[model samples]
Target: MEGPAGEKVPSDNQVKTFERTATGLVREISAFRTLVLDLMFTSPVFMFVFAILGIGIFVGADMVVSTLLALLIGFTTAGMYALLSIAYPRSGGDYIFISRILSPPLGFMVNFVFTIVNISVIGTEAVWVSTMALGPMFSGLGAIMNSSSLASYASVFSQPVYIFIIGAVVMLVFTSVMFFGTGPTFKIKSVLFFVAVFSVIVYIAAIGLTSTSAMISNFNHLSSTSYQQYSGIVTSNGLPEKFEVVPTL
Candidate 1:
């Protein structure tokens, strides 16, 4: 074909094959490691607090049963993700799978929205981690040292500007680590995963060793105080007149 400048342009047959380079990442992660990563992605430790606030408050006694049910549902969802991973076997994951099997337009729309949401949420997550995790750890150190001022210093993270700055710094650090390569990133993640898992196991063991009656009594006492404080707001919203604790063993 003739170019705009009257130069001869190469036809389709002249096109060269694009070569894909080796990323140098070995498939070193084992099944257990993959399971831990997947589980961490799906159900992070932060979600424990969310579940407590969302379901545990009302279903205090039955929270264990509710959690078990949720775990069953999570397993089913994880199975679906596994199937998709096997079918696609690519990094694009759900987007590529859906685009190949279904319509590209639908896949694009789904992924585009998801990408936007995910990107937006990273800032929130960074801010939360800084304020909730780091702040608490610093405060705990302050407490151990018997310095109230040091503990109060954590309040700086609660400021909007400081939160944004810290979140941005966190994003930059992680992004840099990822740019360096997955090896270091995964190593850090693995360490964090083990620590989180150990913490969760210890927490669960403590809960298991506690007496059921004691738990119920504590829940009832807390609920009674909260109910009295928020009864007016609850009634205005057409909620229950009183907080009722679930009766489950």
Candidate 2:
């Protein structure tokens, strides 16, 4: 007999120790693909804001110590998952692995909660990518390149309707990519790896090549505001020149 995926299915169990023949999912994704997915999950584009949030909360924390601690935590967690993958090399993800290895009830509870969190993350991340990432990126590029057309496009992106449309399109595109299959999804992510690398290089170059004065000049050119006026406004409404802990729980 043939299984749904066209793989041959045994009519009877040959091994006396086994209860019966059962169809098992074939593992399709390679180790390299899994590594790529892991890299993309931890990529700066998705994670940079969280890193900033950590800094914000732990203001004046020792950078070296913080980094080492984070590395230790990440390494241990990643190692656990890596070991799990090695033990269960099937297409079935965390839910399947957990259910098979542990109690089904516990696995179900975990997967249920995870699914709920993932739904919220997906919606919010879509909106955030459009508004926070894309909007600022286009605006900054327009400012840097002095492109009136790009600036106009950025203004269009500022509207709620346009932002929603772009976010929906992004969500739809990714959903479709996943629905098609893992192979195509893996290829697309591999391409995005290059794009992410290029973005990081550009970001570093922008920081290294441009000075504070140049940035101020660009802002002035775009906003028609002088550095003195900007400084005054910042002083009036922003953080104090000297750092002090704000009242918080």
The estimated TM-scores of all candidates read: 0.65, 0.69
lDDT of candidate 1 over 6-44, digit per residue (tens): 988779889543222345753556666677777677646
Model 1 lDDT vs. the true structure? 0.69
The sequence of per-residue lDDT tens digits that candidate 2 reaches over residues 67-150 is 566778889978888777666644346776777778788889999999999898888878887677877888878877888887
TM-score of 2: 0.69
Write down the lDDT of every candidate, Cα atoms only. Answer: 0.69, 0.73
**Once superposed on the true structure, which residue ranges of model 2 sit more than 4 Å away at CA?**
1-24, 52-68, 86-93, 96-102, 208-249
Candidate 2: global Cα-lDDT?
Answer: 0.73
